[model samples]
Target: MSSYLIRNAQILGGAPQDILVDGGVIQQIGPGPTVEADIDIDATGLILLPGLVDLHTHLREPGKEDAETVLTGTQAAAKGGFTAVHAMANTTPVADNATVVEQVWQLGRDSGYCDVHPVGAVTVGLEGKELAELAAMHGSAAGVRVFSDDGKCVDDAVLMRAALEFAKSVDGVVAQHAQEPRLTEGAQMNEGTVSAELGLGGWPAVAEEAIIARDVLLAGHLGARLHVCHLSTVGSVRIVRWAKSQGWDVTAEVTPHHLLLTDEMVRSGDPVFKVNPPLRTETDVLALREALADGTIDAVATDHAPHPDADKDCAWAVAAMGMVGLETALSVVQQTMVDTGLMNWEGVADRMSHRPARIGRLTGQGRPIAVGEPANLVLFDPAHRSVVDAATFATRSRNTPFRGLELPGRVHATFLRGMPTVLAGELVDQGDLS
Candidate 1:
C-alpha cells in the first residue's frame, strides 16, 4: 500500500488540517510538523469529505454491457468522488437469485475502483408476480442487503407485504420504485401544463404518490424497513414526512437529476431529458430540495441509468427513458444545494456519504475521517467550474442531460481504502479499452 499526506485540507469544511493516510487507514490528522510519504498532495484550498456513496445506481452489466459494465461504471463512480454504490438489479438476467447477484458482486471486486453492493430483485423478472429468493440472496457470497425492482413497481400488495416481511427477517430493506403502473401506461414525460402543450402522453404525479402512500402504510403496519427510490413529486415528500412523523421505518431518496432538472427540458424534444418518474415541474423541484435540506429526504442517489445512443437518440415516443448520471451527480448537487445556500459542505457529506451508506447497511465505506478509520475520501475544489462534455466521460454512455451545461465543483482526487482510484482529476490505472 502507498502512504499519502494531504496537507492543509479543510475536513468537512472545518478548520484546515493535515491528514496522514497509511496502511489503508487514517493514521493521523491535525497540524503536523512534517510527514514523508510516497505521495504528497498540496490540498491548500480543497475540501476533504468522506467518500460519497450512492444507494441507487444502475450499472447495466451482465446483459447490457453495450451500455455499461461493472468496470467502466465503477471508474465513472471514482471520477464522481464516490467510494461505494449500490448497483440496482434491473439488468438482462435480472439479479433475482444468488448466482447472478454473486456474479455482479465478484465483477465489482475485480474492478478495483470502488465498492459495489448488488441490490437483488424483489420479484422474479421484475414482473411483480412471484417473490424472488430474498433470503437466499441475502445468504449468498454477495450478501445482498437491499432489494428493488427499480425499473418496475411491485404493485401487488400481498407480494409487497411478503417482501417486506422477508426484509424485516434478515435486517435488510426493500426499495420501491413507487409508480402505479395502471396510471402510467404510456407515459412520456411529466403530466402537467408542459405535457398538455406538447401533446405527449403524461405521467401523473399521483401515480408515484399513491404507491409511496400505500408502501409507507404497509411498512408502518408491518414494522419493516422500507426505502422510497427516486422521489420526485412534492406530494411524495409530504407523504414521506408524514410517515416519519408517525415513527415508521421508512426512508426516502431523491436523485441529483430531480433536484436540478425539470420537465421544461422536454420541450426541446430530446430523449435524454426523459426519465422514470420523469423530470417534474419547477415547483416540485424546489420542494424536493427543501425536503432534502430539512432531512425529510434521507439521502441523494444518482439513479445512474445508462443507455446506448441507439436507444436514446430517437423519437420521443420510442426513446429509452434514462440519463447517465454517475459522473455528474456531485456537480449537480453542488449547483442546486450548496451554491444556492440550501445546504453546506457538512450537509453534503451527510446526505451523499454517511446517510446513503447507512441506508445500504454498508459498514466500511462511509466512516468518518478520523484516526483508525478506513481512508475512503474525496478532495473537491468547490471553487472550480466547468461545462460538461459527455464525450470525455469515463462511462460508456453519452445520454447526460447536462451535456453542455456549466456546473460547479470538481473532484481533484478520490481515495478508496487509502488507494487512489482517481488522481489529479484523472482515472488511475486505466487499462486497455479493448
Candidate 2:
C-alpha cells in the first residue's frame, strides 16, 4: 500500500504536529514521527484542514463541456482544497435519473482528484412539475442522497411536500433553490436602491424568504430534511434561525459571493456580478456573516456555477447567472470570515467540511482529522496572498469574479485517501484529461 507523511503542520492553524497516512487512512498524528513513510511532505508552514465539501456546485457536463466537464471541475475542486463536492443536477439532460448521476460519479473516480457526489434533481428536467426517480437514484452506484431543483424552484406546495416526503424514505435532503417564481420573474439584480436606480427588474427578498418559509414548514410537518441553497437575504437568515429554534430539520448555506459582496456592484453592469439569488445589500452581507458565524447558516457552499464566455460575456440581461468559485472559495472565506475574526479556522473546517458532509449524507467525507480517519485533507498557507488570475485555473471556464483582485491565503497541497491530487500550490498530475 502507498504511504505518505506530512511533517510539522498546524492542526487547524494551531501548533505544529505530524501526520502519517497509510492504506488510505491516517495511521498516526502526533508531535513527532510515528512511522516511516515512502513520501514525505514538508508542511512546515501549512495549516492542515479536513478536505472541504461543497454541497452546491455546477459541473456543466453531459452537454456544456465547453463550459465545464466533470474532469476539469474536479481539477478545480482539488485546487480549492476540496476532497469532495456535490455536483448540482443542472445539466442539459439533467441528472434526475440514475444513469446521469452514475456517469458523473464514474467521471469523478476517473479523474482521481475529488469525490463528486451527484445531487439528483427534485423534478424531471427541473420542470418543477412531476417528481423524478428519487428512489432509483438513491440506490444507484452514485448513491445520491441530495436532491435539488437548483436553477429553478419547486413552486407547487403539493409537489414540494411530496418531494420532501419521498426524500425522507431514502434519508435524503431536499435542497430548495428558494425563489418564488412569480416574485422573481424578470429579475435582474436585488430589489434595492441600486437595482431600482439601474432600472432592472428587482429580485425581491420576499421571493426567497417566502419559499424558505414554506419549505421549512413542509419539512417540519413531514419530518424531513431540508437545505436552503445559496441563502442571500437577511430575512432568509431570520427565517432559518426561527426554523432551527423550532427544532426543525432545516440547514442553510451562504455562497462566497453573498458573504463578501453586495448588489451595488450591479451598477457597473458587469455580468459577472449578476448571479442568481442576486447579491443583496451591505446590511445583508453583515447579517449573512453573523448568521454563518453563529451557525444559523450550516455551511459555506461554493455554488460554483461555471459558464462559457459566449454565455457569460454579454449584456447583464442576456448573461448567465453564475461565477466560477471552485478556485477561490477558500481565499474568499478566509478574507471575509477568519481574518475578520468572525470565525476561527476550526469553525471554518466545520462549516466547509464537517457540517456540509453531514448535510449531504456523504459517509466518506467530513470525518475528523484523526488516526484511522480517511486521509482526506488539505494543506493551506494562511499567510500567502495572490492576485486572482482566471488564466491559472484548472477549470475550463474563466468566469471567476475575483480576477485581478488580490486574495489572501492559498491551498498548498491536497491529499485524497492517502494520495496527492495537488502539491506545491499546484495540481499533481494524474496523467491527462484526454
Candidate 3:
C-alpha cells in the first residue's frame, strides 16, 4: 500500500544503487528513479541484501508465551533483518497435527512482521516411537514442508526411515536434531577439558555424530531430503560433506552460536553459553566456519531458543540449554564470517537468506533484489558497532549470550513486502491484521 525509494544502498555488498518499491514489489533500480514515492530512505554507506531467512527458530508460543510468542519472535526477526523463519515444532502441545500447526501458522499470519512457516513434529510428543500425522499436517492449511523433533532426536531407526519415506511423498524434508539421548543423558556441557575441570557431565561429540551418520545413510537409501539441525561437531561436518559428495539430498545447518562461541566460554559457568548440541572446542568452531564458507554447510540457522530469565539464571547444570539468538545472529555472522575475511556479504546472503528459503521451500520471501521481485530487503550499516544489551532486544526473552559484548554491523531498516516492519532501527506497528 506504500511506495518507497531506497537511495544509494550497496546491493549484495556491491556497487551502490537506488531501489524503488511499489505495490509490494521492487519497481526500479538505478542511480536514480524517475518515480515518486511516499517515503524516501537514504541508505548511503549501507549494504542492502535480500531479507534474511532462518531455517531453525523457536517461537515458544501456545504454551510458553511467557518465553516468546509468534508476534514477539517475528518482531525480533524483523529487528535482525529476517523476513522469513521456520518455527521449530517443539512446543508445549507439540505441533504434531494439522490443528496445532495451523494455529501456529495463523498466529504468524497475524504477526505481520515476517513470514513464519510452522515446522511439523516428526513424531507425536517427540516420543520418537511413532510417527506423527505428517501427511495430515502437510495437507493442512499450514502446509508444513519441514518436519522435525528439534528439542528431541527421532532416534528410532525404523521410525526415522518411515518419516523420511513419508516426507519424500510430500516433497518435504525431515530435519533431525541429531543427538543421541542415551549418550547425552545427564550431559551438562560439551565433553572436553573445560567440562572436566568444571566437574560437569560431558556430552560427547559422538552422540551427535552417530545420529547424523545414521540419518544420512537412511536418507541416502530412501532418496529423501534430510536436514541436519544445528550441526556442531567437526565429525558431523565431515559426515555432511561426504553425504553431499554422494549427491544425496542432504543439507546441514550450523547455528550462529556454534559459529562464534566455544566451550571455553562455558568456564564462566554462565548458563547463556549452554545450548543443545552444545558449544564445541575451538577446533570444531573453526571447522564449522570453513564448512559454511565452502558451502559444505547449507545455512546459518539461529536456533533462537528463548527461555525465561528464571530458567536461564540459575546454576549451570540445571539451567536451560539454549541462547536467545535472533536479534544477534547477523552481528555474530558479520564478526565471525565477514570480518574474518572468510566470506563476503554475498556469501552471507546466500547462507542466511537464499539457501534457507530454498531448504524450507518458501515462496516470495528469498527472491533476488531485482525489479519485479518482492521487496523483502534489509539495509545494514556494517561500519556501525555497539555493545550488546539484551534489555534493548525485541524478543520477549533476554537469554542472549552476547550481552555486554561489542558486536559489528547493525540493521538500519528491514522491509517486508514493501512495508517497513522495522525502520530507523525501530519496529513499525502494522496493527492487528488478524
Candidate 4:
C-alpha cells in the first residue's frame, strides 16, 4: 500500500482543499496541508467524493460466465467510481443458500476490486414459492443483510409477509422487484401509445405500484424494512412518498437509465433500451427526478445487467431486458441531475454513494472525506466530456444504449482503501485478471 495526497480538489461540492491519505484513511483535509505522501495527485479542477456505492448490481457469477463474472463486474464497478456494490442473487446457481452466497462473497474479496456484498435470495432459486435459508444465508460468512428476489417479484402476499417477518429478526431488508407478474406477463415494454403502436405487450404502471403498495403495508405490519428496486412510474413514486409519510420503514431506488432515458428511446427498436420496469413516460421521469431530489427516493442504484451481444441484439419482443450501467452511472447522473439544477454534486454523492451505503448497511463505504475516515474516494473531472463506447467497456457485455452519446463528467480515478483501482477511466488489475 502507498500514501497519497490529492491537492486542490473540490470536496463533494465544497470549496477546493487538499486531502492526505495514508494507511487507507484520510489523514488530513485542509488548505495546503504540510504533509507528504508516497504519491501526489494534482486534482486541481476535479471533484472529490466518497466512492459511489451501488445497492443493486448483478455480477452474474456462479453461472452465466459468458455474460459476466465477479471479477469483470467488480472491475467495471471500480471503473465507475464505486467502492462497494451489492451483487444481486439472480446468478446461475442463485445465491439462495449459505454455500453459494459465501462463494460469491469470497470471490469478491479475492478480486480486490471493490467490496461485494451478496444479496441473499428471498425464495429458493428465486421461484417466489419456498422461502430460502434466510437465517442460514444471513449467518454465513457473507453476513448477508439484504434479501431479494431481484429478477422476479415475490408476489405471493403470504410469502412476502413471511419474508418481511423473517427479515425483522435479522435486521435485514427485503428488496422487491415490485412488478406484478400477472400484469407483466409477456410484457415487452412500457404500456402506452408506443407499445400499442409497436404491437408489443405493455407493462402498466399499476403493476409496479400495486406491488409496492402491498409490500410497504406488509413491511409496516411486520415491523420490517422494505426496499423497492428500480421504481419506474409516477404512481409508484407517489406510493413510496405516501408510505414514507405514514412512517413506514420503506426505501426505494431508481436506476440511472430511468432517471435519464425514457420509453421514447425504445422507439429505435434497440434492445439496449429495454429494461425491466421498462423505461417510462416523460411525466414519470420528471416525477422520479423530483422524488429523488426531495428525498422520497433513498438512492440511485445501477441495475447494471450485462448480457452477451447475441442475447441483446434480437428483436424487441425477444431481446434481453437491461443495459450496461456501471461505467456510465456518474456521467448520466451529472448530465441528468446535477447539470439540470435538480441536484448538485453533493446530492449526486449522497444519492450514488452515501445513501446507498446506508441502505445496504455497508459500513466502510460512503464515508465523508474527513480526517480518520476510510480512503474510499473518487476523483471526477466534471468538465470532461466523452461519448459512450461499449467497445471500450471493462465488462464482458456490450449492451449499453449510450454508445456515441456525449455525456458530461468522467471518472478520472477511483481509490479503494488508498489504492487506485481505476486510473484515468481504466481498471487496474491487482493480479486478478488472467
Query: Candidate 2, which segments miss by more than 4 Å at Cα?
Result: 432-434
For every model shown, what is its TM-score relative to the native structure?
0.98, 0.98, 0.99, 0.98
Task: Write candidate 1's Cα lDDT for 240-338 as tens digits.
Answer: 999999999899999999999999999999999989979999999999999999999999999999999999989999999888888889889899999
Residue lDDT tens for model 4, 246-336: 8999999999899988888878888889899799999999999999999999899999999998999887778888888999999988888
lDDT of each prediction vs. the true structure?
A: 0.93, 0.92, 0.93, 0.91
Which residue window of length 10 is worst by lDDT in model 4? 425-434
For model 2, residues 1-434, the per-residue Cα lDDT tens digits are 56888999999989999999888899999988857898888999889999999999899888989999999999999999999999999998999999999998998888889999999998999998899999989999999999999999999999889899988998899999999999888999899898779899999999999999999999999999999999998899999999999999999999999988888888878898889889899999999999999999999999998888988889889998988998899999999999999999999999999999999988889999999999999999999999999999999998888898999999998888888888898898886211
Model 2, position 225, has a per-residue lDDT of 97
**Regions more than 4 Å wrong, model 3:** 432-434
Indicate whether candidate 2 or candidate 3 has the larger TM-score.
3
